[model samples]
Target: MIVTELRFENYRNLKNNTIVPAENVNVIYGENAQGKTNLIEAIWLFCGGHSFRGSKENEMIAFDNKYFRLGMNFFSGGREQSADIAFGQNRKQIWINGVERSSSSYLTEVFSAVVFSPEHLNLIKRGPNIRRRFIDAAICQHRIRYASLLSKYQQIINQRNALLKDIRKHSELKDTLAIWDDSLITVGAMIMKERYDYLKMLREPAKTYHHGISAEKETLDIEYQSTTKTDENDDFGTLTGKLRAAFDASQREDFYTGYTSVGPHRDDLDFKINGISVRRFGSQGQQRSTVLSLKLSEAELLYQKNEERPVILLDDVLSELDNSRQDFLLNKVEAYQVFVTCCEESNKVQLKNGKVFYIENGVVK
Candidate 1:
């Protein structure tokens, strides 16, 4: 998806203004905390997801302002369209082409983007939750229904955990535990299936991108470390049966822990390079390349499924890479519109062709 024009008002530290960017590789440069990433974030919000920086609505409003407003004009579906967002009164509202939408989730189908920042390195350095969230977010972009399924699965897990804790207090309510077990297996199995399939599709592309970035000296491998022990060959029915048995086997442990410990919620992704665990064995450069590969793979999958190139947002990532790696990243994304944030003009000199925006004290010059 190409954004031809983007406008922001009373948003974060940005002055009320708009920018028309080049269709390829727009570089946003400024001093630290001068709203370079803030500009990238304003565009990312249109993707119908929470801020990648994890900011709340009130935090996004400019100082002393009651609300924030953002607008975008873009090219998608063989035509030009527009979308607007306004946040105030403890609520966020969305409108597409002048028609109001009840929720921002509807914009997921209209705009697509893949974002990379220094913090994303946590995908490998952090715990399983980070990797789990990365996979789930990727799946939700194309399979909108998966979002609801995930929500339902979390709710079931929460209820089951609470019931497990209660059963400890009164053993008589133990039999009622079977009710949540049945529902958990039913919903949890589907969650595992979706995660399995999405990882299967993601593995090959990620490896290919990693191979290129690593100069073909390394091999990348991605595997779903399911708590159920299900594999790619397992059918949905088989997944449910295995998950049911797993829950039954883990009952003693679950009861002792006061939580449902065996299901998709406990699953994770394992990344390996050259037969070594990237998390524990890989160098800093290797870790960065692996994350970059996964992100590019995410972008490729979005295009393959949606038939539209997603906007690429790079937040102060180029300065952290070597010259060769930087060139590889820029070349790989040349076919789509990109917005990169950096604190130095030298990073802006890397792109062969692109428009540059300089910002100081929240104003783009």
Candidate 2:
């Protein structure tokens, strides 16, 4: 997918702007706090239906404005499409191809984007929630059904936790607990199976990409750490059995802690190099390379599954890598349309064919 043009109004620092990105590599450069990152954020929001910076729709409006708008034109699978989104304190709407639509439906037809920022290292060093989010976000775009399943699973988990918190006092809540448990097991088991399958598909590509980027000096391994005994080959029945046993074993602890602990919600992804845990032992460079590999792997995975490439968003990450690593990244992304943000003009690396837009204050000059 390629974004041909983007227009933003009262969004972040951009009061009103329109940009036509290069088909191959488009670079936006300026000093810190300029509107470079904001431009990319708008494109990402339109593609994924969420802000990469974790900002809310209302907060994304210009400081004093009460409303914001973002629109983009792109081509996917050889077809042209456009998406427009407007948000305010009390209302929000999305339009695709001149027709009103839900953001979820808009996302399915508009575009897909994969972003890499310096902060992505947190996926490896942080808690399970971050890693889970990484997986879910990628999977949600590729498999729409996964999003519905995840939403259902999260709701069931929340309800079950509430019951657990009160079960001990009521004693009569056991029956209620059973009801949520059944739903949890059903949805949780499916979630776990999908997660395990995604990890399995991600492992080989991530390892291969990491090895190539690292010059084969280090071996990369990805392991899915779940509470259940799930493998790449496990069926739903096996997963259900494992989850059932886990719930039974954790009943006492759950009642005491007022939360259910053993399920996909608590799962994590582990990264290792030469049999050593990267999160605990890898150096900063190693960690960055691991993240780079993981992201590139995601690009390849999306292409493999959908038969089309996803747009690449690089947020102030070029300056974070050495010349060799930067070249590797630049070379690998040549096949897809990329939007990059940099703090200095010098940080804007050379590209074969791309646009270099200068961003200042809140304007693109």
Best-performing candidate as measured by TM-score:
1
lDDT for model 1 comes to 0.88
In model 2, state the lDDT of residue 10.
97
lDDT of 2 by residue, 1-365 (tens): 98998999998998597888889888788898988878878888876457777877888889989899888899887888888888897688888878887655557555888888877889988898999999897787668799999989989988888888878789887877778888888998888877777888888988888877677788999888887666657799988888888898999999999998888888888899988999999988889889878898898899898888889888877765666666666655568888877776644446557788898898997
TM-score of decoy 2: 0.85
* Shift in Å, residue 48, candidate 2: 5.3
Candidate 1 per-residue lDDT over residues 265-337, each given as its tens digit: 8988889999899999988888988998999899999889889999999897777577777777666566889
Misplaced by over 4 Å in model 2 are 63-69, 86-93, 99-104, 158-167, 170-183, 347-349
After superposition, which runs of candidate 1 have C-alpha atoms over 4 Å from their true positions? 88-93, 100-102, 166-179, 347-349
TM per candidate comes to 0.90, 0.85
